[model samples]
Target: MFEPIIPLVLFAIVATTTPGIATTLSTASGAQFGFRRSVPLLVGSAAGLATVTGAAAAGLAGLLLAVPSLQLAMKVIGSLYLVWLAIKIGRSGPPNLDVTMARPNSFLGGAGIQWMNPKGWAMGLGAAASFAALASGPMQLALLLGATFGLAAAASLSLWCVAGMLLARLLKTEWQWRALNIVLGLVLAASIVPMWRSA
Candidate 1:
């Protein structure tokens, strides 16, 4: 049991810490709104990821994976959404840390991103396939996987948020802010590579 659990723990860490839509948004939110205002988004994203994990453990992921048309549709929709998000991020100006001019994302916004994120779906499917066997019962495995992914997502997102906050101090000028936004946006856009390949 212990040995099997170790792999799941490692998988959770890697999945949560990897540079994806959720982490990217969390960092951006922190930079735009600061840590205090970003808490809701982080919590919402964690909860969303947990739900994804549970769905995967319950075999929804497997069904989705088996259907190529659904996968293609998801890829197309997710990619389009990501492109829109990238455009928004790129156009955004440097945040006024003293007085936040740009509004932070809401809890619903955060959750919605996870629901539409192809990367999140992939992570859920991978985790369920790899770790579901570690538990004695189906319900136990789903709960365990969900909790592990949720906690890991929260912790990892918090760290990214802090990193973004630290980076905010360096972006003092308009050009610096624009450059950072463009870079972050591009990085986010690049994350759709897997979806492209799968499609």
Candidate 2:
């Protein structure tokens, strides 16, 4: 039971720590809103990822893998959704966290984002396929996978969020803030590669 724990932890950390859609949003939220205010985004993302990871480990990934049309549809919808999000981020004002600014994303918005995230689905699928011992016999693989991925992803996203917040401090003017935001938006849009490339 404990044999696969070490390898699984390593895999989860490496997989979740990589920069992707979730990290990008976390960064944006942290920059636009303070770290404390962004807690809902982090928590919601973790919960959604955990649910998906657990379900994938329980064999949901294989079902999706077998359906080419479904996969393509999901990819398309997810990509478009992200593009829209990128546009919103790019068009927003500076990271001043002004009271007049529109509200940051809520917990439901954060959770919804993960639901259509192809990259997250791919991560779950990869975890399911890589760890044989995950389903060896204890009937607890889903629980284990969910817990591990959620924690690892949360930690990784928090780091990115902090980085964004720090970057905000370097922007001395409105133009500088706008430029930084546009760059972040572009980076976020570029991150949709996983949605198309995921196997």
Root mean square deviation (Cα) for candidate 1:
7.6
> Residue 121 lDDT in model 1?
71
The 0-to-1 C-alpha lDDT of every candidate, in the order given, reads 0.69, 0.66
Best candidate according to lDDT: 1
Across residues 43-101, which tens digit of lDDT does each residue of candidate 2 receive?
Answer: 88888888788877667434544553554555566456657756776776554332232
Off by over 4 Å in 1: 60-101, 168-199
Question: For candidate 1, what is the TM-score?
Answer: 0.63
Which RMSD does model 2 reach against the true structure? 8.0
lDDT of 1 by residue, 26-116 (tens): 8887877779899988988998888887777667434444553554555465457667767787787765434333688778877787878
